[model samples]
Target: MPENPTSQPVPFRGGGFNPRPRALIGLAVMVVLIAVWETGCRTGIIHPLVLPAPSEAATAFMELVDSGLLWTHLGASLSRLVIGWTAGTILGITVGFAIGLFSLARAGMVPLVAAIFPIPKIALLPLFIIWFGIGEGSKVATILFGTFFPTVVATYGGVDNVDRGLIRMGQSFGLSWVSIVRKIILPGALPAILPGFRISAAIAIVLLVAAEMIGAEFGVGAYILMAGSLMAMDQLIAGVAILSTIGLTVSWIIGRAEKALLRWRV
Candidate 1:
């Protein structure tokens, strides 16, 4: 007699993916932390000089807003970030694809990228200033340079990691080279590439701040530097908060892009 199929144990699926509860919980924890911090500051348990309360930072942020300095600083930083990051990402993607696909590019660019990537990008700021000058050119170049190597590494690595089976299958089907790359390789490599964007974006922001701190008259980094020099913890914290917010915003945008682009995976 055959055994009943129904007698076999079914595999368990994990809990359903509901993000709302987790998000709400995270928000609650942040609120609680802020409340505790505020209470501590008010009770003199935490020194204001060392760590300004969230309220104090908020007040400082508002003052910057009223003085019209916030936009000036923010606009300068945003301009540099957008231009530099965009240029780096585009060039990196192009070079990375070449390195991944062509033997000559891999031989030449791989060694160059590997060499430059290990160097601290901030240390190169003075060199860029000399090359591009002390104006916006140097600052943007710093961010671009910082962003480029990571993007190149990520893109080419992603391409290399694409399954050989898929490429062979495409070739067997008599697909053209361009068609195979467009359809099979790019889609396969996208999962890795998106994460790379996140990393490169973060690096770009750091380099942007570093570049601004060196010679920039108006930028978030410059504002933070001034605040620190004056020992104004509140304003400094506000500058930091702004940077944090920008990071979160970039992450959110990238997340949305991933969702849209990788819908095929789901």
Candidate 2:
């Protein structure tokens, strides 16, 4: 009897081709779009002021780099995001653990957090400006406000859902409360908590741009606004492209860090 083809085992494909082909296809698509855009601009079908070609944007970006202005603005924005997100994450973790562990803290803080979380951060941007001035302080405060609520909610849920049995196992081993939390609770809750950090990183970047638009002297947001006012469409687009790249890079790095640090988790 002839063997059935369906009964034959199919050979497994290697992982090497998985990402490479997809990346190549994406690159090809982008090249085609850029070529079309450049052709349109050169033919005067698309006004340079309205939609600058990729070449024009690239030239503007190179000029900014040569003038050393791009790095300076990027540094300012990066500093604000790092400081604000760090502060927000620390507070979120502390408050989340407190509420998850103690009924008293939950009863006291949950309502307050709920009330504030619904308010738009942009609506309070004016108040932050008034309180912190139009300096780095205001920008940082705005990013922190934008990031804090999401971080708190995600982390609190993670901690609250920690398995009680694991905690008891630690306790039975004569572990102190701190030791039990460090060994059992945090590890158990890490999968949930890590996603919150990723969310906060994205929120921090977005809010940093919004904050910088409000009279900031240096930063990506301010640069985009300045370019727009000057009718420098290429520069404006270049600034936006830079910000997008930064956000992507930060997200990828943090995800890799999470995988490495929480290797023990499910």
Candidate 3:
């Protein structure tokens, strides 16, 4: 019997990782959660002291905006986040590349990184305050310290994961070491590095908030701390919402970057 061509498998298309349906489902879940939360508050099933209603949180957010306090807090947090994260990421990439490429650096740095990476960065906040002083410096240092280790681990791991066959192929084509690294290794390592950015960015934000809550007076963390002390659940929830917004914005930015930089993959 002859095989029928029409019965051949159609190559699967439009069935993998569709963002629209995923996004819609996520949005639906969020809407349902919010609706349930609001209903619970209205029905007195949830204590306002424990968790403010969404509407109350929204009102508090609006008041902060109208009072110009939002920008003040946002500006301080953004400055610390950018400076600390950038500094840490740059250093991590540099050191990670060195460690990945050179046995000497690996011998010296890998154990040190392993030693430090597992230590709770928040636990060092007091030490940072003592060293850098109770100011922007300390806050930034806390975030920087928290962000650095993960990035280092990520970068070197990325470099290590690059295919040896490709490196040999580059060398066979008479590519210089530097040229091969730039053209092949870096590009190959980028996918790993970009994901590391997301992790480091999140760590930076959390550390930033912790550091701010300690001694800073005009950051989102500080605002939350004050609200908690005063039992202002609405303002505290508003501050939390701001943090969520910041996380979402950062994730979106990283996603855009991945799309732009990793276009060659597709």
- Residue 146, model 1: lDDT of 84
Cα-based lDDT for every prediction: 0.93, 0.87, 0.93
Considering summed lDDT, which 10 consecutive residues are worst modelled in model 2? 14-23
Q: Which stretches of candidate 2 lie over 4 Å from their true place?
A: 1-36, 39-45
Sorted on TM-score, highest at the top, how do the candidates line up? Answer: 3, 1, 2
Cα lDDT of model 1 by residue, 1-266, tens digit: 26665565678988878655355887799899999999999999999887999999999999999999999999999999999999999999899999999999999999899899999889988999999999899999988988889989999999999999999999999999999989998888899889999999999889888899988899999999999999999999999999999999999999999999999885
lDDT of 3 at 64: 100
Question: Taking the tens digit of each residue's C-alpha lDDT, what string does model 3 give over 82-179?
Answer: 99999999999998888888999999999999999999899998999899999998998888888899999999999999999999999999999999
Model 2, 1-266: lDDT tens per residue? 26664565668776674554355886799789889999999999998778998888999999999999988999999999899999988888888888888999999989988999888787789999899987888888988887888888887899888888888888888999999888888888777888888888988888888898898889999999999999999999999889888988988888898989888757
Any idea what lDDT model 3 has? 0.93
Candidate 3: segments with Cα more than 4 A from true spot = 1-21
Each model's backbone clash number:
0, 0, 0
Query: Native-vs-model 2 lDDT?
Result: 0.87
